[model samples]
Target: MARRKGNNRKKTFGARDDRNNGEWTEIKKDNEKWETYYKAQKFIPEKDWDFFKKTCQTQLPLTFRITGNRKHANEILDIFKTKHLPQLGNVEFEGEIIKPPVNLPWYPDNLAWQLDVSKTVIRKNEQFSKTQRFLVLETSAGNISRQEAVSMIPPLLLDVEPHHKVLDTCAAPGSKTAQLIESLHSTSDEPTGFVIANDADARRSHMLVHQLKRLNSPNLLVVNHDAQFFPRIQIENNGKKSFVLFDRILCDVPCSGDGTMRKNINVWKDWNTQGGLGLHTVQYNILTRGLKLLKKGGRLVYSTCSLNPVENEAVVAQALRQWGDKIKLVDCSDRLPGLIREKGVSDWLVYDRNMDLKTKENRGDIKESCFPPTKEEAENFHLDRCIRVYQHFQNTGGFFIAVFEKNGETQKDAVVDEPPKEEPNSAIVKKMKTDSGDVVVTKKEKLPRDANEEPFIFIPSVHPELEKCWKFYGVDDKFDKNNCLVRNATGDPTRVVYTVSKSLKNIIESNEDRMKFIYAGVKLFVAQRSDIECPWRVQSESIPIMKHHMNSARVVECTEDALKVLLTHAFPTFDDFKDESLVSKLKELKTGCIFVSIKRNDPLKEDLFLPVWNGSKCANLMVAKDDTHELLYRIFGIETTRNEQKKPQQQDEKKEEGKMTENKI
Candidate 1:
């Protein structure tokens, strides 16, 4: 739909039109204005116009994908198939029998599923409501996420590997970044490949952090940077400073978002033809910058949630024209089986400010940026390589994706001429012009930064305290100490010590002067003054990465009964356990966090390893609250009650109340 340009257009606010109380009547209302716009598009087949319009006006079906790297991924899939699917049966709608929920054909491993019913219908049905509750619980626990089908396509197209350096240029509310993290860790327990998720907005970057924190991967790093001018960091390897290039780059740039009409009802009212035209420059610049950051032969997937060719094809065409032989579109038709998509259009009419088709006489009125390529330019550009996902074709939101492969040699001196300046309040620390005529942008916030500029100090190999921790935990003496770094050089009661990847460590040390580090790696160990037996306590979050490397004395095997007690109680005393053997084993352990294993006798079930802290008189589970609850429910068929859960703040409150009473006396 072509939207006319206007300088003083009235702002449109989205309002719920709940005329019909039973179902989604607001979405079903026919908007002739939007329909007329769709009719003008040449790429959409005339026969499919009716279906496209109807689909755009309907509420999108709820869909979600299972997290690939979670411990309970397979278990959750099994529960959905064997338990949830059976109870769903068949739903009836408008005198028609609708089949049960099915997996999305294009999504890998049959992980993505569609409810195939309206939200109201799911709310009213008892079985559906129960299934919904299960979904909500799993989502809250980060085992699964509710995302659209088309939104999942870009990451799959990127085909990320465990050892490839990756970047998501515009990651925010980071669902795609989470997918990248999952893909990076899908094949390996400890991934060498690192992901740099960046967004222009600082607030959204923090939101990205909160979303990705659930995955708990040490290889992922969050940065706030404008995609149009993302910085290049030099890695210090063997006393040399080398530019960092990504093996895979995802340029999911911001767009008009007209394609998300089914879910975001506000789009229908706020739709403007000028929206795509206005964003074309920014989109092209981001894609171009992403290509510059990409390594030779690296793949960059350029995508948008808008259906407008001006925002999709035109922007990609501009990049191709500028780069020439350095980049080429990769055909992805064979990648996603059963996905319905249209080829990118070579020809599209530009609309003037009055919503009229631009003619030779009025061509100047329309921006040249919105103009389509000539016939010869279109043929050479290979526009057909791009994929356009329409709402009617797959019952999914509209999307555009184009995969570009960097070829031949790397562009060492790649630079944007007369680059646009950042906003006054941007998070950019400084922009410097380099000798190579390239711009280097640095961020303001750095993770794991020392206030006094102290060099990262490694734990000494033969130190008395270090040896004590190694012996107490039964950790191997040969375990690499170089990866571990204390916060300060003096190391006077440091709160936490972090272990970073080899690549990340190089970047951290070399680029300290140029870039701000916000967060780099996972916390390896935390100091515990309460545990005089072992001052250096292992972090629970680091268990997954350190499990295989640890062969320490602190590891113990516990019975199923003991595991159930530990999972249910925040702090369980020796008397809380029913197993005498478990109590005997606990008494022999040091007062610190230790690995506990619960071996299942059933061959079908996998053994579980957990971390718990052994206090002077009691033991505390070091696992996350959601994880503890899930484990308790899975093992003992018992859901923890609010009263039984003891929070650390509650004890502090009781102590404060006692002090208040004493003062009154």
Candidate 2:
């Protein structure tokens, strides 16, 4: 159980004492340069300029959204309302009572929360510490993730469904990609839709895998690709190789990040007028490619964390002009009911790198594609459909989101000129030649290596070993074995088996020549060659899916005490059980991993399911270390100390050494 404290303490916000602590003090920087730039720009309304500037200088409030589509979601939310909320009574700022932490109204079901106080204050206050601890624990457990409130807005506006094919072009340190996956799995046990999360940087793409690994959904794939030139993949659907287009695409392109000044304090020192101007070309290219890859009548969302009009409206304007009839801005004003946002700007001056206006006389230095649209063109662009979320209004980080719907016409038929490509060097020019009336361009670079280089080999479900193991374990007949693939093609004694959805499998097999996959699907089983009842063993990570699909013949319903002891030790002998019935039940079972469930006595607590491997002399708990600790504390009134936890592993190591000694003798 989680501990709660400071229920009776009175808390205050914005007090002088709060500011005296260096931790809570906001870093003040010279914003005269930005103020001057904003004064010259007409995009921001003069009336709101002061408020925006003040808010930009202040520290951003802490915010996070509860993860959807998980077993422990409701329980975590309940803990916040019942245990955490009461502890954070009323906050008093300057001797006046202010509202405590509140949920963002526009966020669904009040799942998103905000702490109005600064980070320093939260660490200092006892009540706040309790709330913070809960959030930290839940985040580490993968039940929740910490993200800026405004950052969560784009995926919500996308309106993703369980059956819509989705793509996130610039997903890295993927918080929004996680949201997209959650929304994709919102309504179904198994989502038919799949998300392809791509990033230009290979390191960041791998980092995305680590971030989303906790979700453990099979309907996701991480890839490395430059957003501006993402490859066109072909998937075999209905026995035909058709070009794959996403039903929904997220173009959260890289930006100057001016809007993140509140959180990224270093941006204050690095502010420049030329930053947005320099990134406009790259941003436009990425969005254009995203639109081209979108399916006809599908939706694409373009977003940025920069408040500069050059990166926000100008890029959208350019794409709109190029694909006039094939794309239109989607009106999302009513999408999030209570969200406070400003309408996008249609009028903004274009400046050169030197901060001088680029008129027709001085426009020779500017590329035609980089030029801002004319007055008439801006009107038809429908820039007002875009949303600009300023930091001041909601006390959150700034963001800009614009949704677009592709028309029924194919992008290939649209009379849009492709961007100019760079000239090839002498060596590349020699490789490209006309052969058999087709232009053949030789590959310039070799494909990068991944963690697993073994070819995916499927196991025959009817094989003698697999049949015997399934029957002995009473595996569900409905479980599709065709989707299971072994690591090695040859009959290797010990290898890992993984499962991929049919659609994803088709995508991978068909596009193996074009795209590079970083990671895909979950590990379902690990084969072990031993003198045991079954040759194959189900991995603990696959327990959630297997438990629901497998029969109860191999499951053992253990008492609370027995469950606690099993979780506390690594491999316990028969004498370790307090109940003789449990020991007898275990002795009769085959030598393999079996499911163990604890009967729930508390209405608030959920039953615990774990896996334990039975050996001739002792049994080993196959659950993760963190999970073991959590279950022991939650199910039984037991807290495992670090020393107690290490004993089990040390004992197992000694036992292995003793076996080696006996073998030598």
lDDT (C-alpha) at residue 417 in model 2: 46
lDDT of each: 0.73, 0.73
Question: How do the residues 332-417 of candidate 1 rate in per-residue lDDT, one tens digit apiece?
Answer: 88988989898998877666544667754567755575677878888899999999999998788999999999885545534434
Runs off by more than 4 Å, candidate 2: 1-28, 31-33, 42-47, 90-100, 116-127, 367-372, 411-469, 486-493, 527-529, 558-584, 598-608, 616-620, 632-665
Q: What is residue 91's positional error in candidate 1, in angstroms?
A: 5.2
- Evaluate candidate 2 by giving its C-alpha RMSD to the native, one decimal: 10.0
Model 2 quality (TM-score): 0.81
Cα lDDT, model 1, residue 218: 76
- Off by more than 4 A, model 1: 1-12, 15-33, 70-72, 91-99, 118-124, 359-362, 365-369, 410-471, 477-480, 484-493, 529-531, 569-580, 601-606, 616-618, 636-665
- Clash count of each predicted structure: 11, 1
Reference-based lDDT, residue 163, model 2? 93
- TM-score on alpha carbons, each prediction: 0.83, 0.81
